[model samples]
Target: MGTSWSARIVDAPPDSAMAIEAVLNRVIAQMSNWEADSAISRFNAAPVGKWMALPADMMTVLRAGLYMARLSGGAFDPAVGRLVARWGFGPDGLTGLSAAPNHPAPWTAIEVEGDRARRTADVTLDFSGIAKGFAVDAVAMALHDLGATHFLVEIGGELRGQGVKPDLQPWWVDVEAPPGLFLPTLRIALCGLSVATSGDYRNFREVDGTRLSHSIDPKTGAPIANDVASVTVLHESAMLADAWATAIMILGQDRGMALATRQGIAACLMQRTASGGQEYMTPALAAMLE
Candidate 1:
């Protein structure tokens, strides 16, 4: 919600843009951590051990986040919201944080029942990793409801594509190599798939003379230190792709690639190298390119 969004739909009504923006605005109201009045912010600011009613969409994303936290063995935790705030990535906007606390809360602190949720401990939830992908899917659904048969929805680089262009060509997205690394723009076809990328090259800081990623590993409650430049995942659901990309980014090169292979997911990971950069792809991702 802090970033921009764009959508392109074939033979769309002129008001399609407005419709997409309205949908995005709804998503922002529901889940934006930057917005003080957002549902997530309200939940985060709520007192501990209080059950709060959440919208269906918010509940869905929360469930997905919890699933990812378990699937990644705490590597991708929603309970790290306080860690994000302490590290100056939260709404407070205080930069140059000297230190960070360990995961402020555990996922187990959360209890969800139907449309109501509560924290057993001093837990906070953040959806920074998965909200945009969910918003993209929301836009896709909105467009379809508006009678769009072919479209591409993107928010902050996360993308979802359905059908094809009027010319019958699939939506093409250009994947750039990480900054300070020289490589050609890799064009990826986005047809019947959703794609998301988690990169360490952007949104980072220099702590103790070492460049560190802004993405905190929930297991450590610290900025990630790894050779991974970026990990891109392609899935049928953009929200799942978004969560998987963050998980793989936190897992680093070897383990991430191993999980990608074991799970049989489409993932392309690039790691930084002294010479330049090296690419790693799971069998599914390689097959997609082929």
Candidate 2:
């Protein structure tokens, strides 16, 4: 939550507004790496045999991430931390390699024990998939507790909306496709719903003529090279939506859509064409667009 976050509530009381701001501030403090004592920073520093009891916010995110990994057949894995770190996405700098380490995936080697998690493999846990969405949900709950009935919450690109504006309409959101592509905007009415988007556009580096994305495939321990460029998931919980979006992206277009359909999750995938054009959602995902 060190990144930007916004909320809109209609006709909120002054005290409620202040409480909402306080909640956002707390989220930023807990999630930001700039703060030395942030939960994420502490988790990163935690060593083996040291059982760290995660806060409720971080616990919710880890649980959601694990659930998504199971749901996606380990396609969406938080155990790619070592690979992420080697790529210079973590607190450490890059390993000067064009690709990730050629090791087996780490998710299968990690273990979760109640509020404490451990990794037997030489990997760390990167919660980037679910942290933003969890923060959004947490802040939204805080606002709701402060007596704000209708509002929208967003952390980074993940979003959650509840009830409606005073005018009696659900919060509307526009889903954008990746760059250098043309596609119709997805208009969603968020009524007690959460949505999350995961894409390769913003987080990628180029080595030679090939482009490598930050999101890794746990099975291969490598960056995913697929036709799909982005995936958006809509679900009851923001954390689940966020993790699922990343998992779907890792699973690639065909298998990703199949998994989504099997799980009855609404998903949208934006694909890049060889001609530099864009293809819209898959049939299963397009059905959810309506």
Q: Who wins the TM-score comparison?
A: 1
List per-prediction Cα lDDT, in the order shown.
Answer: 0.85, 0.76
Tens digit per residue, CA lDDT, model 2, 175-225:
977887688778898989899999988888888878888888877766789
Worst 10 residues of 2 by lDDT: 277-286
lDDT value, residue 214 of candidate 2: 83
Q: Pick the candidate with the highest lDDT.
A: 1
Q: Assess the local accuracy of residue 264 in candidate 1 as a C-alpha lDDT between 0 and 100.
A: 87
lDDT value, residue 88 of candidate 1: 73
